[model samples]
Target: MLTVSIWIASSFMGLALLLNLYRLLRGPDIPDRIVALDTAYVNALSLLVLFGIQQGSRAYFEIALLMGMVGFVGTAMLAKYLLRGDIIE
Candidate 1:
């Protein structure tokens, strides 16, 4: 039952990933691309958590946490750059 749920979640995540990838590739505006990238990172994070649970590996969770932090920082910095044209004031 748990395995089935994980598989179903993973499948939906995969579909979301594809859609986000398309947006990232074909977005008409910079903000749209940024949003797509953020979504991709979030979906990737969820997938990592699910994979960690499936594999019973604490390391995967640690990595996922790190990725989430990095993704958040990166997105913030990118947004700052887009808004102010500079990452650092």
Candidate 2:
């Protein structure tokens, strides 16, 4: 039933991604949009890891790591901009 579990996890992640997208589109504030984007990134990473495991590929894991790094950087920059109106000092 490992395959079944993987499929279930993938479905859940996909649903989460869609929900996050809705939030991103309709967020009432900058912070809310940023938070939704961060959550979407995390869900994407989990989906990547699951796909990697299912396909026995290491590349997906690497991509997920890179995406995580990018997501963190993006979130930080967005949050800084929201607070100070600029990403650069």
Candidate 3:
């Protein structure tokens, strides 16, 4: 059933998010933390998409798009800051 499939997908995404959180907390370096944060953002996006499917709502899709944009910007800034030690530069 569609509902069962959605539940399973949601469970997997939840697990992924937990793993990402562990990495973010246990990272031995800043870059590792950054990557973990990026991955968390992606997993969160997937959860949002799954919720959108389950609820049949367009708003979740819109929110997911917005989050994806923010995630991209955040990831880029994190990488840039790590490389140059200044995000604005």
Best-performing candidate as measured by lDDT: 1
Per-residue lDDT of model 2, residues 1-89, tens digit only: 98999999999999999999999999998889999999998998999999999999999999999999999999999989999998888
C-alpha positional error of residue 85 in candidate 3 after TM-score superposition, expressed in Å:
0.8
Least well predicted 10-residue stretch by lDDT in candidate 3: 80-89
TM-score of 3: 0.97
Worst 10 residues of 2 by lDDT: 80-89
Q: Quick one: ranking by TM-score, best first?
A: 3, 1, 2
CA deviation > 4 Å runs, candidate 3: none
The residue ranges of model 1 lying beyond 4 angstroms of the native Cα positions read none
lDDT comparing candidate 3 with the true structure: 0.96
What does candidate 1's lDDT look like per residue over 1-89, in tens digits? 99999999999999999999999999999999999999999999999999999999999999999999999999999999998999987
For candidate 2, the C-alpha RMSD (Å) to the true structure equals 0.7
Using TM-score as the measure, name the better of candidate 2 and candidate 3: 3
- Give TM per candidate: 0.97, 0.96, 0.97
What is the Å distance of residue 67 in model 2 from its true position?
Answer: 0.8
lDDT ranking, high to low: 1, 3, 2
Superposed by TM-score, candidate 1 places the C-alpha of residue 86 at a distance from the truth, in angstroms, of 0.9
